[model samples]
Target: MNINNAYVIAKKEFGFNIKNHWFLLSSVIFCFLNFIIIYFGEIISGDYSQTDIRSLSLSIIHLQMYLIPLFSFILSYDAILSERESGVLDLILSYRVTLLEVMFGKLLGNCIVFTISFLLGFLPVFLYLYFLGIKFLVLFKFVLVSIWLSFIFNSFALYVSNSSKDRTFVILLSIFIWLFFIFVYDIIFTFFVVLFYGSISNYFLNFLLFFNPAEMFRLISIFYFIPNDITDLFGINVSSFNNFYVCLSMFIWVVFVFFSFLFFYFEKK
Candidate 1:
């Protein structure tokens, strides 16, 4: 909780990683890939100018749902693991920094880079959609939801980095996190629907959908940009949309994951 110590650690983390050639190169590649996806998504829609912004944005989000989370994972999975493995953790703590300071500092540094890279990668898409008739507010909301998803994933990566000792195990858990959120979660919900078979109401199921950060990003986009009487996501029906709930869900995910990292893994096992 010492702000000065945290700042010192954060500065060091930021300074060291920002110069990493692989990090910079991958960031550039991610941004380029994002642009390519949208550029083609518009052109392939048959007429770039006449394409619906909502549909295009949704498509971008759908595909990005895969890319961004994985990118965030790569950014931080080794944040703590490498330090501990190399005995740098003690060196860091020896400088009058507490474990909380180390954790917060590292998380803050990674998030700064994540935020910048995430926004820059999506910059082309934002401008392209705005010129094609999407309102600023809607695009802003879309950006916010996407950013929240990235933050959630980054926290999970950091949490795994904080808790796990073996680098190989961390990689496996990161892959599992991506798979569970993007794919396995829907399957689980579908199985539940089949098992319940009309016994469970869609409202309850929809409300439960808010629990997953990935789903929340897609749901918020669908709710705000493509509103309808009812929206179905992989057999999970969403009957209502509340701004409070949406914000609360994302807030909870970010807080829960960070605290989980702090409380559950403050000291190495």
Candidate 2:
């Protein structure tokens, strides 16, 4: 791999991303929306109590879940296919940069841009929580999980973009995958649990929880706010398991999806 060329590509992409007016405008709008929603909700209900704070925080968490995937998909869905369609792929290929370098550089650029956008949206929400007397550790964990989840979504988007030639197909596929994990998966899981009813064992639910990212995020967020007894009823024991395991799983998912992209790029090159 040509490290210098890779760096050059990454720097160019980063510069373009920084100058992109649409992205900057969107980030500002999202931050304003977050502030408006939370502030208005509190004002109208006249309930700035602890319960309201927790509900607002969880709503912000849900917003992150929705926006992160959308931002990552929009950034990555055209990474390679656009170049290929424009006939610039041949020129880039002739520049002595390895496919690995190009792919890695593109992935890095997208991750950085999307991460910044995600953080921008979180800043207002963070300040709101702080003013509400939320614990520093609780706020910190929410930001950490938001960034980590953004990384996971970035990897997933890059993998999908690399695997497909049509940009439209890539976008659609990313949306489908997000919807599957975010909404459909849990609904399906609930259906199975209800169908089995008393016949289903504890182990099956545990197994389901292990692979469900949406559930994992919700469990962690709830554990941060609620009592242990309530969390137990939710079927997640955040304190029982090591936190490192969750971080490791997220890291592994990022690396796994990244390698999958590399494998597809090389196999088809």
Candidate 3:
């Protein structure tokens, strides 16, 4: 609980993750993706050009919903376990720091690295769009939420890393979580709706979507930015999703994440 000790751990973590080759490689890839989104739009979302900020922003959100979570997982999946395996985590724990501080430091450090890496790629494209009189606040806004996404999977990765005895298991679990939350979860949710068509209310279905952070993030990116006519970032007129529920459900999801993180650190060494 000592802020100084936590800052020390955070600073150490920051230094280590800063030189990560994966972060640099991913940043370059991110820049390339943004370039495609800006100029050669038809390649991805078929928005066809940069003038359509809404569609382009939607494309950006979808892209982040995929890439950011994977990047986060890869970056933090071994945050504690590798250190534990190598005895570094025990060394850090011997310091006058609480386990909570250590975990917080690791989470903060990785989150900062991911955000900076994202911004390094995002800012140039944002400036170009700004000159074209197109609003890029959508990108800016999601960059803020990107930290939350990073934290979610970073914590998930860290938790899975801690809860087991095998690093291979940790890696496999990370991949499964990334795939399930991003791709399979939504498909299964839709199948459930289809299987129970008239029985399932759209409101409940709408609430169900946000249970997965990726979907919650996708909707959160749009709900405050776009007009009332649009429900989701895709503009797929699925149903009238409530803004109030969006806010409520996101709060619940975050709380769920918080307790999930808390229980792991408390129960583990």
Candidate 4:
């Protein structure tokens, strides 16, 4: 519970991750791929207008759905399990530090490192687009939302890490979680909508969208940018909730899974 102990642990975790070769490689690939995608996406959209922020934002959102989950899972899937397997957790727990401190510290450290990596990868493209006359204001909001979205997934990975001691199992579970949200959830949602569009209550449909963090993030990010006509066609009813609700949903996901991590950590202790 001591702030100083947590801060110290956070620094250690951050340094460990920053120095890891896998983190470095993943970050490089992330930066290079996102850079190319953003650059070409704008061109393909055929809207070079300086004020056309929606096109650029949509492009970034599409890539982020895949890239952010991959980065978060890789960085955090072994946060606790690896330490336990190597006996490092035992050594660390022998200290004056509480398990809560360790958990908070590790999560905070990884989040900070991920934020730094995200900025390094995306800021250049952000500035480039800004100079091209696209409003930086909207892009700024996108960056913030994207970082929060990454944190949400990172928390989920940490929960998985806390639950499993097997590294192979943890990794496979992480990928499956990613696949379920990013791809499977939508397919299932669409199937339901197609089958029961008229019968399914709007309230129930909204709940389903909010049920998946990935889908929630996508809806929030593009909610402002998408035209009402398009949403109407799909019967999404985006007007049912505002940005605050979307942000709150993400925060809830982080807190919920984080508590799961703490629960497992304590039960083992």
Count of residue pairs whose backbone atoms collide, per candidate: 0, 0, 0, 0
Q: Which ten contiguous residues of candidate 3 have the minimum total lDDT?
A: 229-238
| Model 4 ranges off by over 4 Å | 21-24, 42-55, 227-235
**TM-score winner, 1 or 2:** 1
Runs of candidate 3 exceeding 4 Å displacement? 42-54, 131-136, 224-229, 232-247
Could you tell me how far off, in angstroms, the CA of residue 93 lies in candidate 2 after the best superposition?
1.5
Query: Sort by TM-score, best first: what order?
Result: 1, 4, 3, 2
Off by over 4 Å in 2: 48-51, 197-204, 225-242
Each prediction's TM-score versus the true structure: 0.89, 0.84, 0.85, 0.87
Tens-digit per-residue lDDT, 1-269, candidate 1: 68888788778788777777445665677678767777787678878557766566677777777877888899888988999999999898887777778777887777777767767767766787788777889888887877777777877887888767989999999999999998999789778777986788877887767667787787877776766623655555566567877777778887787777667644542
Clash pairs for candidate 2: none
Clashes of 2: 0
lDDT value, residue 71 of candidate 4? 89
- Candidate 4: give the clashing pairs: none
**What TM-score would candidate 1 get against the native?**
0.89
Sort by lDDT, top down from the best: 4, 1, 3, 2
Q: Could you tell me the lDDT of residue 216 within candidate 3?
A: 82
For model 2 the local lDDT of residue 126 reads 76
